[model samples]
Target: MAGHDLGFQVVYRGETLEYYRPGGWVFFQRPKDCGGGYWLGRTYDGVFMIEYERPVSLSDGMDFLASMKKVEAKSEEFDPNYSLF
Candidate 1:
């Protein structure tokens, strides 16, 4: 496993957590909502869409996530695309 220390955005409900870099794949490991274990997030296309990975335990999840840096979403000028509206 390569060092997973790339600045990524934390995805909250409704916020567009889209990003990319010129490298291999980047992923995120977060605690599961059900509280059993944790789930992983990955990219799809160019947008930062979250794809799940095999579930891991809490301790394992934290350790895996720790390997990667956490970045809170930064969209000071987050404007919605309302072409449909």
Candidate 2:
């Protein structure tokens, strides 16, 4: 698992899987497999996009995502809008 400042990003290639967790909301892209390549991205507005030439297993994708390390903010700078109440 990896750590970032936002939320979590999970990556799976071949038999290896990696996980990343940041402090913000978690987001993910649909998995894809093709003879050439695939592309996926999340927009700043929270829109997720996935383009693939072949189908991918949903179970594998979810498993990879679920393995993301849980990360919590250690400082107030992580969330300026946080309320103590």
Candidate 3:
């Protein structure tokens, strides 16, 4: 599934950021005035990164949150030794 290709990495500042997805998702680690909001997207072939600004609706945020929850849940099902990191 597409979500399987989606992963995340913690940046140097300790913020958890999404990565390697077929398409990007917007992330706001801070308020807008601080340039805190940005879109992290993937290329059409899902091999590159694209950053941009776009208004994200509440429903879209909810959906992304739900997907994140699922990812977390799945992570719990794995054996500790299986962790790639």
Candidate 4:
């Protein structure tokens, strides 16, 4: 599938992220409830980075997500159940 056929755009910090269904999913991790943090997305192109406009504080938590060094992955390695959310 091509990007235009089944793609979605994600807007963050006034930036647009063009994601395609055939390109798999964009994966990233950010801080939780400790002011505004950064959002990094691992897409078929490269690591997508975004920053919040303002900071907001709340409960604190930490989570580490795997980094995608390269955009291309083996078809068998693709996870159907995987999602960025």
CA shift of 57, model 2, Å = 1.1
Off by over 4 Å in 4: 1-12, 22-34, 38-63, 67-85
Q: Which scores greater on TM-score, model 1 or model 2?
A: 1
- How high is each candidate's TM-score? 0.30, 0.24, 0.30, 0.20
Model 3 quality (TM-score): 0.30
Better of 2 and 4 by TM-score: 2
85, model 2: CA deviation in Å?
A: 42
> How big is the positional error of residue 75 in model 4, measured in Å on the Cα after superposition?
16
Model 4 weakest lDDT span, ten residues long: 58-67
The candidate that wins on lDDT is: 1
lDDT of candidate 3 at residue 74, scale 0 to 100: 89
State the lDDT of candidate 3 residue by residue for 7-77, as single tens digits: 42212223543443345443433345655443433333535453434634334544665676699788867
Candidate 1 residue pairs in clash (backbone atoms < 3 Å) = none
**Candidate 2's residue-wise lDDT over 1-85, tens digit each?**
2323424343334432233222332233334444322222223343334422243344443444345332223333466797999
In model 4, the number of clashes is 1
**RMSD after CA superposition, every candidate:** 15.1, 12.6, 13.0, 13.1
Candidate 4: tens digits of C-alpha lDDT, residues 1-85: 1123222223334344544433443322334554444432324555443322233221111122211322334444868899999
Q: Which one is best on TM-score?
A: 1
Ranking of models by lDDT: 1, 3, 2, 4
Whole-model lDDT values for every prediction: 0.44, 0.36, 0.44, 0.34
